[model samples]
Target: MLTKRIIPCLDIKDGRVVKGVKFLGLKDAGDPVEVARVYDKEEADELVFLDITASFENRKTLVELVEKIAKNIFMPFTVGGGVGDIGDIRNILNAGAEKVSVNTQAVKLPQLISEASKRFGSQCIVVAIDAKLVTSHQSPVTSNGQGTDKWEVYINGGRTPTGLDAVEWARKAAKLGAGEILLTSMDYDGTKDGFDIGLTKAITEAVGIPVIASGGAGKPEHFFDVFSKTSADAGLAASIFHYQEYSVRQVKECLREKGIPVRL
Candidate 1:
C-alpha cells in the first residue's frame, strides 16, 4: 500500500504566505521561503505553494519565489495559481516545481490539461478543483430520497461558480490525463473542522488519479479520520501548520500510532 502523504500548503498572496477562512479575511502567516524550509525540515511528504490571487490579478505564478523555496526544500514541490498555458507550466517546472496545478485555466480550457500532460507527462500535471457544497434546492434528487449534496466547482480562487459537479470534473480530469487531483472544499477551507470526508471520498472513487484532500484540518485526529474513512492519497492543511498549531512530525506520529503508514 502507498504510504499516506501529509502536505503543507502555502497560500501565497503578494509574494508572502497568508491564511484565510473559507477563502476570505486573509491574514499574513510568514515568508514563503522560510515556511517551506520549516516543513522540509519537519519531513513533510510534500509542499504546495499556491499564488492565491494570481488568477484574479491576471499574472503568472511567482517563479522566483518558487525557485527560492525549491532551493531550500528537498521534497517534491507543486505550484499553482495564474498558470495559463503550457508555457507557464514549463516555466514553473523549470523553476524547480515537480508538478504544476492548474485550476481556472483548466476549467476555462480543459484542453490545457491534455496539452500539458502530453507535453510534460501526466505525472507533471495536477488539476485543482475548488468545490463548494450545493443546497438541496440546487442539488439533484437521488434514489435515497435525499437530495444529493453535490459539490460545485468554483474557479478564480473560489470567486466564480462554474455549475460543474466536482465528482464529474474529477473523472474528466483523470480521463484528460491529469496525474492527480487537488480537491479543496471551499466550505471547509481554513475552518479546521476537518476535511470534507464525503467530498474527498466521492472524488477519490470517481477518479483513478491520486486525490489530495484539502481544507478543514484542525488536529492530528482529523488526518487519521480522513485517511481511515476515505481513499484519498493525501491530506493537505494550511492554517494548522502555518500557525504552528501542530507540527508535521506530530501528525505523522499520530497516524503511525493509528496504524496508518507514513514516512516518519
Candidate 2:
C-alpha cells in the first residue's frame, strides 16, 4: 500500500497565517515563514499555502510570501488562492511551489485546469474544491451524517456557489488532466469534530487522482478516522497543528500505531 500523507495547511490572509470555523471569523495563527519552518521540522508530508482572501479581493497570490515559505520548507509545497491564469501558475511554480492549486478560477474557466495541466505536467496541477452540504433544513450542515446528502461547489473563498455538484466537478477536473483534488468541506471547516467522511468518500470515489481530505480535524484520531474510513490519500488540518494541539510527528505515530502506513 502507498504510504498515506499528512499535510498541514497555512491559510493566509493579509500575509499572516489564519484559521477560522466554516471559513468565517478568521484568527491569526502566526507568521507564514515561521509556521512553515515548524511544519518542516515536524516532518509534515507536504505543506499547502492558501491565500484565503486573494480570490475574493481580486488579487494575485503573494509570490514574495510564497517564496519565503518555500525557502524554509523542505517538503513539497502547494500554493493556491487568487490564481487567475497560466502566467500566475507559472509565477507560483517558479517561486518554488511543487504544485499550484486552482479553485475559483478553475470553476469559472475550467479550461484553465486543462491548460495548466498540459503546460506544467498534471503532477504540478491540483484542483481544489470547496464544497458544502445542500441540505433541506435551515440550520447549518456541519457533518455529512447521511450518506445521501448532496454537495454543491462553492468558489471565491467559499463565498459563492457555482451550482456545480462536488463529485461531478471532481470527475470533470480529473478528466481535464488535474493530477489531484484538494477537497475541503466548508461546513465542517474548523469545527475540529472530525472530517466530512461522506464528502471525502464521494470525491475520492468519483476521481482516480489522489484526494486530500480537509476540514474538521480536531485530534490525531480524526486523521486515523478519515484515513481508515474513506479512500483519502492524505489528511489535512490547520487549527490543530497551528495551535499546537498536536504535532505532525504525533499524528504520524498515531497512524502507524493504528496500522496505517506513513513515512515516519
Candidate 3:
C-alpha cells in the first residue's frame, strides 16, 4: 500500500480559519498562516486551505491569503472555494498553491475541468465534492432498484444541491482528467464521530485517481478506520486538528502502529 496521507484542513472565512458543524454555525479557529505553520510543524502530509465562503459570496479565492499561507508552509498546499474558471485556477497556482480545488464551478462547467487539466496538468487540479446522504426512501429509485443509499452532490458550501450522484460525478471527474477527488461528507462534517466509510468507499471504487476522505474525523482511530475500511489515499480533518484534539503526528503514529503504511 502507498503511504496514507494525514491532511489537516484549514477552512478560512473572512481571512481567518474557522470550523463548524455540518457547514453551519461556523466558529473562528485562528489565523490561516499561523494555523498553517502549526500544521506544517506537525508534519501534516498536505494543507487544504479553503475559503469556505468564497463561492456563496461570489468572489475569487483570496490570492493574497493563499500566498501568505503558502509562503509559511512547506508541505503541499491546496486552495479551494470560489474557483470558477481557468484564470482562477492559474491565479491560485501562481499565488503558490500547488493544487486548485474546484467544486461549484466544476459542476456548473465541467468543461473547465478538461481545460484546466490540459492547461495546468491533471496533478494541479483537485476537484472537491461536498456530499450528503440521500436514502432509498428519499429517492426510492436507483438504476438497479436495490434500495441502495445515494449521496447527492452539493455546492456553494453545501447550501445548493445539484442533483448529481456523488459516485457518478466522481467517475466523470476522473474521466475529465481530475488528478484527485477531495470527498467531504456533509452529514458527517464536524460531527467528529468518524468518516463516512461507505461514502468514501463508493467514490474510491468508482474513480481511478486518489480520493481523500474528509469530514467527521475525531480521533486517531477515526483515521485508522477510514484507511483500513476504504481505499482512501488520505484522511482530512479540521476540528480535530484545529481544536488540538489530535495532531497530525499522533494520527500518523497511530496509523503506522496499526499496520497501515504512513509517513512518520
* Structure candidate 3, residue pairs in collision: none
RMSD for each model, in Å, please? 4.5, 4.2, 4.6
Reference-based lDDT, each prediction: 0.84, 0.85, 0.83
Which residue runs of candidate 3 sit more than 4 Å off their true CA positions? 20-29, 55-61, 138-147
Worst lDDT 10-window in candidate 1: 138-147
Q: What is the TM-score of each candidate against the true structure?
A: 0.89, 0.89, 0.89
Error of 3 at 80 (Å): 0.4
The positional error of residue 88 in candidate 1, measured at the CA in angstroms, is 0.7
Q: In model 2, which residue pairs have backbone atoms overlapping below 3 Å?
A: none
Tens-digit per-residue lDDT, 1-264, candidate 2: 689999988888877777632222223236777677777877899999888767534343378777777777777989888889998899889888999999988999999999999999999999999998887763345445455667899998888998999989999999999999999999889788889888998888889999999999999999999999899999998888776778889999999999999998
lDDT, residue 156, model 3? 87
lDDT of 1 by residue, 153-221 (tens): 999889999999988999999999999999998877867888887788788878888999998999999
TM-score of 1: 0.89
